[model samples]
Target chain A: MDTAGATRILAVVTPDSGLVGPGGAPVFMAHSQEEQERLALLLARIMGGVPHDLENGVYIVVKHS
Target chain B: MQNHVLTILLGVVAGTLARLVMLRSDYRHYPSYPHGFVTHISLGFIAALVGAVAVPALAKPDYVAATFLILAAQQFREIRNMERETLARIEQTKLVQRGSDYIEGIAGVFEARNYLVIITALATSGANHLWGWPVALGVAVISLVISHLLMQGECVGDIADVVPGKVHFDRSLLMVGDVVIMNVGLPAFREKVLEEGRGVVLKPRDDDARLTLDSIGQRQAILHDISVILGTKIDEKEMEFMPLAKKNADTGEIGIFLLPNEPDLECLVEIIKKVPVIESSKARPLSSYYGRRAAD
Candidate 1:
């Protein structure tokens, strides 16, 4: 893979809707903390990426190809 | 003329024998694919033939035939390209990849082995023409030993010490020693990593070793070798179990974390020690004037 093509954010899951802005990856807004973690992990498995916690209630599924 | 036949035949045998010995001695099961095995052997035979012919052709005063050896060198270069292209293409599908530096080292070794065969063939054949069959046989045996000695490359263990490191979570961050591997979002994922994941810190013996360990490609090679040998727990969709190596900025120690199917920490350490030092990644800081002064 090329230098820039290796890592990509496939999806983002956050409990607070205002925490993350709509950007490169699809953003999924979940209600509760439990739901946010579930959605993040589900999307991570689907996209073959790892769910990384930003520690601010935001989880990003980053694919390190 | 009779001696010429004996010289060429003996040279071919010696050269091909050198190639076979080299292949068998390698620790990594490379050329495991049937096609790759066949191709390497065929190329080795061709390399032997060219090398064997060189001495006889030159002795026979055949100027035209001598120039053919130059053509054979061009052919040898293509073998390096062929090996590199094949490995790079296959790298895409691997969960743990042999990095570009490792690939380049492998390709370069293949090309150098061909040259070794040429030298073995030339030496044996030249000996036969000068002396006789018995002397030629002795030359062949000695040349094979010399070739093996020449190819005895360094391993990671020679320059560093690998010891078990603590795999623990600092909040959401995975820590192997002081190196921060990565962040984990899912609590379940964090639990699995803490339970099953193994960590090892490779401590460099000197500044040169530290510089070598700092190479990203070299670190990737270490991870790939371990993942392949022990069998990774990573599945197609399970990227969380994937292995990683992170460098400690302060001490230049490399902290590696991997979830292996085997889970044998002892065996894992042994495998890490044996990881072939990537030629491109090796640095010689102590040998340089400025580097030596800076070390003081």
Candidate 2:
């Protein structure tokens, strides 16, 4: 099995656009695909796990079985 | 025959008398100045004048010949003196040049560690030996080669010197990180936002939060945010906030920009202090970095 290719993943971070949140507070929206990856990475780092079958432009939290 | 002899005799007598008068005058007093040439010329002219006046008893041709001989002697003396003076001046200049080179060498070592004076000295020496077209071209080539080698050697030497004491030295001051930030972001934002006659206000998520900028764009935004936070009314239509990468003009502290949020500004300083100074591996001629503007 090609373990290196199978396990290795790359994430590219980019700037997000500003948006109005539910509380009328100015919250930066993760508009760019790069920002989405960054958010996923941040979430995973914080959670201490990676998600299974991650979406294209959403937070991914991977888990080690 | 008697008249010819008399003319020759009188010319010599006149020339000798004039020389004696000059030798007694200021010529002997001011030895430093080229008084010898003045003495010979004045005496030669006086002899010629006196010989012309006394030529009534002597043959005109003999008198003329005598005058010419006196003039020739004067010229010969003057030329010899001039040659000696020229050699002395050259020696003096060489001495001064060597002294200058020594001072420059010491300064280069202390102030600008990436400086070399030997290359300049070698180039000047080479120029002295070489002359027209081929030599001129050769000297130029050699100078450029020497300069490059010197720069490379100095850079390598600096790195070697610094590497051993890297842990002890504060390396952040030497880093061109601010220059990198300026190059990457300032121009882009300056054109897109500032130049386009648009007013944009940036405020931190938390009122107490200090924005730590990694690029010039972020720095500019932070500056704008600071001005707004301070309630400083900047006419965005007329005035644009220029984020200059400089320290406080009043204080000697480096990398401290004029911006709002006192705590954040202090934090930026702390962060910058931690970054290591960047080193250029390749050597380049300083002339290449200089622009062609005559005023500059």
Candidate 3:
């Protein structure tokens, strides 16, 4: 209902170890080409959110209303 | 009858002057050419002429004649539509486009200004008829000042704090303050952003300010103004490098990360301050009781 706050981050995944994706908006940091491809496949499976591979070596998953 | 003629002429002169005063081409470069400027001035002159004649026509007991003023007012709305269409068409060619919201706000202002000119002309001319040239001149001065004041509107910095921040990365994510702008996939682009980009944090002073800043249109206006002044690093293919404003979900502070042609942080800050708050995005919750409680 609140359009202003409509965009919510589903997770933040990172390439760094011990870092976790926050449940809501997943942010993925792909460290290697293999990891990047693997993460891309996993992101493709998620139905509720959209994963964007920002050309800057990171993947961000965002959810829309 | 002669006095009526004199009064109508006085109104036309005063109204024409008022219209001429308000018409200008500034940062937006709208009415960019002499032809556009002349067209607006001519329309303004007609609006003023119509407004001035209304009073005299009514006084002569020609109520039917005064109805023409209403018709003239309707034409001003067409002016608004024309401006909106022209700006909308022109916007497509812009590198950093002024979003529809900003364009609408500008079109609305241009339309309203014609009405102001009408009022100024009507009042001055009416005074001239009732009193004399001396009193009408005084009335004209007062109305012009009032018009000038009414024309002044709020800018971004009036309701928020804009301060230059650093454009650095938290790993691969680009950020300004706590707001994560976007994730940069290319290290080279990231390095370029770090080298040339500037960051500014906009902290809203209150609830209304927060809401206003939240409007997408207002943010776009800020970006457009910055691009107009400093030039943007936006290439047609490089959408990632486009200037972006992201809000800190927790703090409500908005951060702008831009790679400008001129990276003078202080000048960037000044330009941000001067950027007009889009009219549609302007919020005034303090005027309402419920909004007041939310502010607290």
Best TM-score among the predictions, by candidate number: 1
State the C-alpha lDDT per candidate: 0.88, 0.31, 0.80
lDDT of 3 by residue, B51-133 (tens): 88888887787988888678868889998899899989988788788999999998998888889888988998889878887
Instruction: Please tell me which model should have the higher DockQ, number 2 or number 3.
Output: 3
Superposition error at B254 for model 2 (Å): 43
Instruction: Rank by lDDT, highest first.
Output: 1, 3, 2
Best by DockQ: 1
Q: Rank the candidates by TM-score, best first.
A: 1, 3, 2
Question: Which should have the higher TM-score, number 1 or number 3?
Answer: 1
> CAPRI band of model 3?
incorrect
Give per-residue lDDT, candidate 3, residue B168.
Answer: 88
The alpha-carbon lDDT assigned to residue B264 of candidate 2 equals 39
Q: Residue B213 lDDT in model 2?
A: 23
Q: Residue-wise lDDT of candidate 1 within B1-296, one digit each (tens)?
A: 78888899999999999998877523455777677777777788888888888888888799899897878767899989988998899998988889999999999999999999888988999898889889999999999999999887889999999999999999999999999998878988899998999999999999999999999888999998998888898888787877999988999999999999988899989999998889999999999999999988
TM-scores of chain A across candidates: 0.85, 0.39, 0.49
Give residue B162's lDDT in candidate 1 (0 to 100): 94
**Over the full model, what C-alpha lDDT does candidate 3 score relative to the true structure?**
0.80
Candidate 3 interface RMSD (Å): 8.3
Interface RMSD of each: 1.0, 18.6, 8.3
